[model samples]
Target: MRAISMQEFGGPEVLRIADVPIPQPRGAHHLLNVSRAGVNYADVHVRGNTYLAPVTLPYIPGNEVVGTTPDGQRFVGLTPGGGYAEQALVHRRVAWPVPDDISDDQAVALALQGQSAWHLLFTAAGLRAGERVVIPAAAGGVGSLAVQLAKRAGATVIALASTEQKRHVARDLGADAVVDSTADDLTDRIREAARGPVQVALEMTGGKVLQATLAALAPRGRLVVYGYASGEAATVVTHALMEKSLTVSGFWLPHLYGDRGALPTSMEELFQAVRDGDLKPIVGKIYPLGEASVAHSRLAARDHIGKLALDVTR
Candidate 1:
């Protein structure tokens, strides 16, 4: 099997495609003939050595994929390092069966992002119907799914993106309103467009955007911080929280799956939504397995509108 490996972490250039031996599934683990691999910000972080977990050197970097197990069962789940290869292994407990209607590319794109968005809205934030929610980076993988899920939950969604093209993508995904975060007065614009305080804010970009999101939340409203795309993490001012009685929470998908034991349920709901046409992943670009480095560069540049995937079987 061919895989992309990083002997050392630094930049996109470090990712090198090389032929490697296929891995075998051990007890309770299943081997997958990877069809498509999901590319995430976490992969970029791992490549740059900024991941929360220390990734050993000379390792593959993808965390999730959609593929068939040794028994010919189709599923999706975390693969840690070897997902960038043609074949990988995932834990049986973490893997969920993919619907027949969902394509391999869509399955790969949605597995992690869909699960994360569902947990963030339904589980972590406890978003209620008729609530107003704001999602930053609304055209990205998680944000796109967040828009669809929030709308399905009956919440009015405000999507924030950097480009008009991205805003259009968000609008097509069913966002109630779109805000261009690159504009000078982003918070004011969001408030003006929303007509009131946002009840829930799904913040991915940290730094100034996170601060603005906190300011825009309604009293006692929740702000869920999931990622720091600005290359720097944001710190909340505790005193400000007291004044508004605001709730600030951080959501990490792995932690949510590990702590609440809701991974299977979330995956089931997301895949069902996909099957029913209520939810769909926006696949931005597809790259062959050998061009994994280029995919990483595209993700790092923030050039794609939605999820990028590696077509391993192609």
Candidate 2:
């Protein structure tokens, strides 16, 4: 089996292609002939050794993938060991049978990033119907799904994207409004674009964006911080939250994956949503398996939109 191996934590250049032994399944874990590996921001963190969970050396970095079993059952799932390979292992409990109508790309997209979006909005943030929500990085993998999922939950979504092309992508995904993510008056723009007070916000990009989004929140507003793509720490004031009655919550998919019903239920719902045409997973650039470095580079640089994947079959 060929996989992307990393011996040290550093930049994207650290990832390289290598031939490795195929992992055999134990207990209920299934061995998948992986066709496509889902590339995510978490994978970038894993490669750089900055992930919340410690990563072991001589590691192959990939969290999700879509492939077939020995019986030809197509499934998409979270691979804790590694997913960037010709074959990978996923416990049966965490794997979901891919819908016949869903493509490998869409199935893989729903694996990690999709699961994160679902949990962040409905669980962590406690999103309710008819509320206003802000989704930053509106064109990226998780952001694109967040925009769609927020709208499907009957929330008015205000999407933020750094480029016009990305903003347009958000609009097409049913975002109620779109704003320039890099605008100087971003906080004001988000406030102006909303129908009323901004009630719920998803803040992944850190630094000034976090501060601006926090400032734009209404009294009693809820903000969920999931990632800091800007590679900067967020400054939050305790006194401000107390005075405004605001809530700041953090979400990491790894922790949620441990819960019994978390991944299975959400994966089923996400796949069903995609199959029903109510939700669309944007499959962005596809890189050859050996070019994992390129994939990491593009993701870290925020150069791609929607879900980027590695075609192991290539």
Candidate 3:
């Protein structure tokens, strides 16, 4: 099997393709023939050694894969490691049969980002119909799905993107209004779009963006911090939250999937949405397995919208 292995923590250049022995199933894990792998910010963090959990050297970075068994049963799910390879050892419980209506590339998109969006809106935020919600980075994988899912749940969504092109993508995905986060009047624009204080904020990028979104929250509102893409720690003023009765919390996908770790019910709903054409996972770019380093560079550049994937078959 050929895999992209990171021998040291550094830039995308560290991801080198190497021929390695194919892994076999151990205990509850199953051998997976990797067809496609989702390239995410999480992978970038892992490669740079900046993730919340420390990463061991000389390890494969991917976590999500769409692939099959030797018998040709196709599945899409999370992998413990080796997802960027031609084959991987996947936990049996995390893998699920891919719906016939969905393509392998699309299924790859749902593996992590779809699950994160579902959990962010329903589990972490407890979003309600007719409420106002603000989502930052709304044209990216999780944000794009969040915009669509939030709209489906009857929430008025204010999407924040960095460019006009991305904002247009957000609007097409059903965001009620879209704002450029780079704008000087970002907070004001968001408030105007929502027509009042926002009830739920799906915050990913930290730093000044987090500070702005925190100030825009309504009384008794909920703020879910899922990612710090800006690479800056967001500081919260408890007194500010106390004055408005606002609440703040953080969400991590791994923590949400407890002991048994089976794919949750929300995944089923998300897949059904795709089958019914109510949801679409955008595949912005696809690179061959050997070009893993370039994929990482594009993701790190942050100019692309939607999901970036590795085509292992190529």
Give the candidate number with the greatest lDDT.
2
lDDT of 3 by residue, 1-314 (tens): 78998899999899999888888669976677889999999999999888877788789889999988888988887875679999988777777888788899888888899999988999889999999999988999999999988988999999999999999999999999999898777778889999988999989889889989988889999999999888999899999989999999998887755535335587798888887777888988999998999999998889999999999988
Q: How close is candidate 3 to the true structure, as a TM-score?
A: 0.97
* For model 2, the run of ten residues with the poorest summed lDDT: 254-263
Q: Which ranges of candidate 3 are over 4 A from the true structure?
A: 259-262
lDDT of 2 by residue, 1-314 (tens): 89998989899888889998889669888899999998888888888778988888999999899999999999998988589999999988788888788999888888888999999999999999999999999999999998989888899999999999999999999998999989898899999999556999999899999999998899999999999989899889999899889999998887876789888888888977887787898889999998889998999889798899999999
Stretches of candidate 2 off by over 4 Å are: none
- Listed in order, each prediction's TM-score against the native is 0.97, 0.97, 0.97
lDDT of 1 by residue, 1-314 (tens): 88988899888889888888788558978788988899899999999999877898889989898888768889887866788988888987777788777888778776788888998998888999999999988888999999998998899999999889999999999999999987767778888778989898988888888888788888898998888989777888899999999999888877754543688878778877887788988878999888888998988888688889898886
State in Å the error of residue 308, model 1.
0.4
Candidate 1 lDDT for residue 7:
91
Once superposed on the true structure, which residue ranges of model 1 sit more than 4 Å away at CA?
259-261
Clash statistics: count for each candidate: 0, 0, 0
**Candidate 2 global CA lDDT score:** 0.90
